[model samples]
Target: WTEHADKKGRVFYWNPASRHSSWQHPLTPSHKALVAAYRRIMQEEDRLAAIQSELEAFQQQVEEEVKGWRQSHAPDGTPYFYKIGTQNTRWDNPRDELMAHMDLRMKMLQELSQMPSLLEEVAPPADVTGLDRTQDSAGLSEAAALTDGPGSPVAP
Candidate 1:
């Protein structure tokens, strides 16, 4: 920051990098305000760090609690999780919905793999154009068979 004088000869501070001009000197009460603001920012950073530490500790506690659940398979080959300490048991797997979706996708893929790659449904007959068509007994070309009359009335 540098000091400059306006056309009227009044002392003004100018910051070339920020293109800012101030009538007050830099070392005045603005220095105290800057120091107070710096203190506030440091306090906020410390508070956020404390909050993050608490969240991490809470996450660790949850992970440790989840580790107590034991997985076992039923006689019919179905899986379940049991937490003996908490007397909690569930027949359905926690990831059952996602696994069921993946199972359906796999089944569809297997069925598609068994089909012929070039398989196609039956196509309609080729259209008979005006060329190489003999006039019918009604004196109408084969291409004129598209008439709205009954039974097409082409007479073969």
Candidate 2:
């Protein structure tokens, strides 16, 4: 293989006795430019592949976390749905509803957990005194009321 440079200072390789005649022939400025562009495209592809691998790793980590959470919080032994319209069993335990509530809480907590990192990326908010940062438990009470309300299977 012989290396050659075009008028534009672009480089190419000349391979003799190759099935591809283009490689054996002298490269023009356009051909050199195409080669450079191809090299750049290959470099970009490599960089993207690295980024894709990182993303896959991160995805696997998240999946594992979710699996572990499900195993710990939502065991298979626990029934997720309750049967209705049965005299032998008038009502089922509110475990499924409670699990849904727990799942929602987990998702909210995950979102809230990212707030510190997001805040770090931007300017800090102005400090204000006497402002309440704590969440009210009224919503929790409301949810409980709903669970024990009429039409609820758990309701006596």
Candidate 3:
């Protein structure tokens, strides 16, 4: 087999015995099917890589957010604890509000933990070339908008 390049710089492989160019050579059905499958595989692999990268970025963001929340709420690094006892052991002012906030934060972390499995369950679309695969600050902007708005849990 010999490889030849046309005037347009397109290269193709063909048998030396053939008089016609590689392009003029007839491709068998199986050869066409193999080429189509190869293209599909390449496209799918690219899509999967993009999705994996996005998922990793999202995972890192969740971890950082949870870490920041924990640091801000508990600078001492002590885990929140609740104790049930008689009136003598119970303080007059219970930290129910702080506990509620901590509960919400815990729930958020729990939801974040499920992200990896969710990512695994996601499949690449048939046509990934047209999809926006960029990882940008749009998600952060949306999150900030939600948190910095009026009646938000956190103060500006």
Over the stretch 1-156, how does candidate 3's per-residue lDDT look in tens digits?
356887998877665332334554333432453344334434553544544444454455445434333211235664433233322221212233234333444444345445564335556566423322334576432232223333444444
Looking at model 1, report the run of 10 residues with the lowest lDDT sum.
94-103
Q: Give residue 156's error in model 2 in angstroms.
A: 76
Q: Give the candidate order by descending lDDT.
A: 1, 3, 2
Best by TM-score: 1
Q: Write the residue-wise lDDT of candidate 1 on 13-43 in tens digits.
A: 9866435679987445534533453344335
How far residue 149's Cα lies from its native spot in candidate 1, in Å, is: 93
State in Å the error of residue 28, model 3.
Answer: 10
Candidate 3: stretches off by over 4 Å: 7-10, 17-20, 24-120, 123-145, 148-156
lDDT for model 1: 0.53
Question: After aligning candidate 3 to the native by TM-score, how far in Å is the CA of 74 from where it should be?
Answer: 89
After superposing candidate 1, which stretches have Cα over 4 Å from the reference?
A: 1-45, 93-156
In model 1, how many backbone clashes occur?
0
- Global lDDT of model 3: 0.41
